[model samples]
Structures are given as structure tokens and as C-alpha cells.
Target: MDPVDIGLWGVPLAILAGAIRVSTPFLFVSLGECLTERSGRINLGLEGTLIFGAMSGYAIAYETGSPFLGVAAAALAGVVFGLFHGWVCKFKGVNDIAIGIALMLLGTGLAFFFGKPYIQPVAPKLPSISLGGWSDVPQVQAALQVNVLFLFGAVLAVFLWWMFRATRVGLVIRVVGDSSDAARAMGLNADRVRLLSTAAGGAFAGIAGAYLSLYYPGSWNEGVSSGQGLMAVALVIFARWNPINCFWAALLFGGAGALGPALQSVGVSEGYYLFFAAPYVLTLGLLIATSSPERAMQGAPAELSITK
Candidate 1:
């Protein structure tokens, strides 16, 4: 009946909207991670990659006046980082997990150093589809304003799912991930497969970065990532390395992430911190839930460090 009551009632709608908006980055990052894990390698440095891509993408967009160009730059930056990580991990003595962590720090450091200059610039945003156009209510319309990246991610999920089941490249990647020895016996180059997968994964993460700065929360800042990249690792596990499942898992995490803001919109500011904590809570919960009795991931690549 009152403003507070009205706000409270609108919370659900707000959360739904927030979920769609916030889920884009998660979807992209998780998909990228899905790709990497599918290749039997763990890249802990993706957090760094996310940050660097965010910075690089934002800077490029600001300079080029083309948000799409920023996306391209972010993907390129991600490829470079991915290639670096993949190459270093090829040595017999190299540890993928350790290298991943190192890369995380390196990526974050580089992002901060180079991102300082572009923090204040206003970059163009990519177009969005008005999914809620059928609704006359502003809230409904706003809630349904889907970003193009979200659509692309949905398509990617299906494509990857199909790729894994129907394509030679996918088969080779799965073979290399499942058993390096078996792959070698089959004359498949496991290391090469992993390198390319990691690079592709990095490219995915970069696109995610572009989504963040070019669209929602559109800005170049040191704290732009907020662990979306890291949290994606758990999301991938929850999805059991299934590409299609990754999309659903990302949406779930996105809804959880939106919990805090949704409550705030309804004047329910009490325990706001707890609401904001929902995403982290969901991340930990997913990890615990997805772990097997053997303590290995349910559908992880056998060659992954966690399984080893």
C-alpha cells in the first residue's frame, strides 16, 4: 500500500532483472572455463585474465569509439594470456595450477597498471534486444532487456554441447583431456590440443570482460571482475563440465548474485551485506555439492590437477 510495500512487492521482478543483467559475465566466464576444463587443464589465472581483458577492452573501446572493437581487443589479450599459460605449462617440470595462480597475479597487476588511464572514459555500449517489449510496465520491460552477449552465450552453449558430441576437434580435445597416454597412442598431440583450448578459453574470458565494461557496470576500474572469473571454476564443476549445463548454472549463480540488489530495491536494506554475500555462498555450496566421494570433480577432465 505504501512505497516500502510497493518496493517489497517489486523485489522479485527486480531480482529477475538483475539476474539477467548480472548473469552475462558469469555465463561467458563459465563457458570459457568449461572449454578449458574440457581440455584437461586447470587455469587458475583466469581471474587475472578477466581483469586484464576488462582493462584492455575498456581502453580500446574508449580509444576506438567502437564497443565491438573493444571486444575484439579483449579477446586478443585473452589469447595472448592463454597462450602464455599454455606454453609455460608444457614443460615437464611445470605445474599447471601453480602457473595458473602466477598468471592470475600477473594479469591483475597488468590490468591495474594499464587501466589507470581509462578509468574516467565513457565507452559505447553494444546493442541489446528488448525482450520485454511486450510489457507496458517499465519494470517488466527493463527486466527483460537482454544483452546480445547473453544471446550469444546461449547459442555458444548449444554449439559447444554439439561440438563435444559431434565433431572431430571436440573428440580430440576430449581424448587428450581424458587420457594423455591414450591420445599419444592414437597419435594425437595432447599438448597442442590443450594449448589451443586454453587459448580459446582465454578468448571467451576476454569477451566476458568486454561485456562487463561495455555494458552493465560499464567502466574501467581495478575491481571490475569481483571474482566472476574464479567463481566460474565452481560453476563449471556444478555443470559437470557439460556446456549446456553451464548456461543454466550461470543463470542460477546470477540470480544468487542479484539477491542483494533486489532486496535493496524494495527498501529491505536489513542484512544487505548477507544478501550480497549470496553469490559467494552459492559458489562454496556448489563446490561442496559437486565434489565426489573420491574428492575429485564428477565430470572433470582426468588430466586436470584437481583430479590428480
Candidate 2:
């Protein structure tokens, strides 16, 4: 194929790869947030949790030479963060959003403080699957090197979707999220449910962080996250708190993120910054399209404040 034909053809292929690569973290974090939101709370501190998870995962992997161990440590850190968020929100007159922002700053500061030392080291990377083993082209092989986390995220999405629809625990979470008063009437421990859900959400966010440091970027750095944590909150909203939709929305965001680099590689350099902003632009557009001033006020949770 001619260079032009290759470029044209490769764009779509590259986009597909990028979508898978970039969407993995989004998938994890969004699913986590979906769980948290479904329980009638939001944790904005995922940004910090993500960065911290990256640092913890990278540090553990580097020290033990085990990527799996690193993932476990990262998840532990996420659980801790989630517990902290839950604990704080359980107090009287505490603002969850404000606490979320504070936790974000705290997580970022902690990551920067500890991540400085591990900046230069290399850690074990996650294994990839070669789905295109039959292909002869190097580009095809490279593109086919899929992350294991992506598959896990896919499976988790399907599992969560099923659980939410069919499981008793999922029913409890939905009950708590949709109406805490009803939960109280049913004699369910609303606070405990929220706490557990929040911690699980944080653990998933941490796993997303692990993917960033140990796989995609493959190193620990203060700047490892780059607002993916925050964008994920927006993604959860766009997904309508559905785990299955979170998967597709994450892939879309991932594709938008890859547009700039893909275009640049093909010598389309104009408006590079705009390309970089594609995900955020899409996010804003989707938010505007989905949000209704009247409907949101009527349908939004009484205790939840983001919509207000």
C-alpha cells in the first residue's frame, strides 16, 4: 500500500488500539464511581487515589519484581482512601464534594512527596496478549498487544451489570442510592453500605491507577494521572451510572484522547491542542446534551449536591 493509503487505513486501526489502551483506566474508575454513586454518594478524590495508586503500584512492583503484588498494594491504598472519604462524609455537616477536592489535593501531595524517589526506576510491566499472532506486519503485531487489564475491565463490566440486575447486594446498593429513607425503613444499615461501596470504588480507582503506571506509561511520576481521575467523574455521569455504559463511554473517551497523537503521527499537526482537548470537549458536549435544568432538579437525589 502507498504511504497515503497506509496513513488513511492506519488512522482507524490506531484509533481502535488507542481506545482499548486509554479506556482501561477509565473503565475501572468509572465502574468504581458507578458503584459509589449508585449507593447515593460521590467520591471526587479519585484523582488523587489514582496518582497514589500509580505510585504505590509502581513502587511495590519495583521492589518485589512482581506486578501482581504491586496491584494488590495499590488496591490496598485505594481502599484506605475510600474509607477515609467515607468516614469523613459520615460526619455531620460535612460536604462530600469539598472533602473530595481536599482528598484530591492530599492524594496528589502524598504522591508527589513519595513518588519523587521512584521517578527514575523501572518496574515490572503487565503481560499483554497477542491477538494478532497470525499477522506478519510489525504495526499489526504492536497494535494487537492488548493489556490484560482491558480484558479484566470488560469482564468486570459485564459482571457488575449482571449483579446490579440480579443480585441481592446490588439491590441493596441501588436501594441506598435511589432512596436512603426507604433503606432506613427496610432496616438496612445505610451508612455501612455506603462505606463498603465507597471503599470498593476506591479500590477500583486504584486499580486504574496501577494500569497507568505499571502498563501504559509504565513508570511512576508525579504527573502520571493528568486529570483522568477527574474526567472519570464526568464519565460516570455520562454513563448514567451504568457499568455497561461506563465501558463504552470509557472507550469513547479513550479514542478522543488518542486523536491528537494519532493525527500528529500522520503529519496532521494543525490544531494539536484542540485534538488534545477532544475528550473534555466531548465531555462538556455530552453533559450539556444530557442535563436538563428542570428534570435534573426533579430527579436528582435530595442528599446529593452535584446536580444542584
Q: Which digits, one per residue and each the tens of the lDDT, describe model 2 over residues 93-148?
A: 88889999999999999989998889998999998898978977666677788999
Question: What would the TM-scores of all predictions be?
Answer: 0.96, 0.94
Across 1-308, the per-residue lDDT of candidate 1 in tens digits comes to: 11233455578888888888888889888888889888999888889998899999999988999999999999999999999999999999899999999999999999999888898878888888998777667777777888898999999999999999999999999999999999999999889999999999999999999888889888888888889999998888888899999999888988998888888886778898888789999989877776667654767789998887
Model 2 compared with the native: what TM-score? 0.94
Clashes of each: 0, 0
Total backbone clashes of candidate 1, pairs 3 or more residues apart or in separate chains: 0
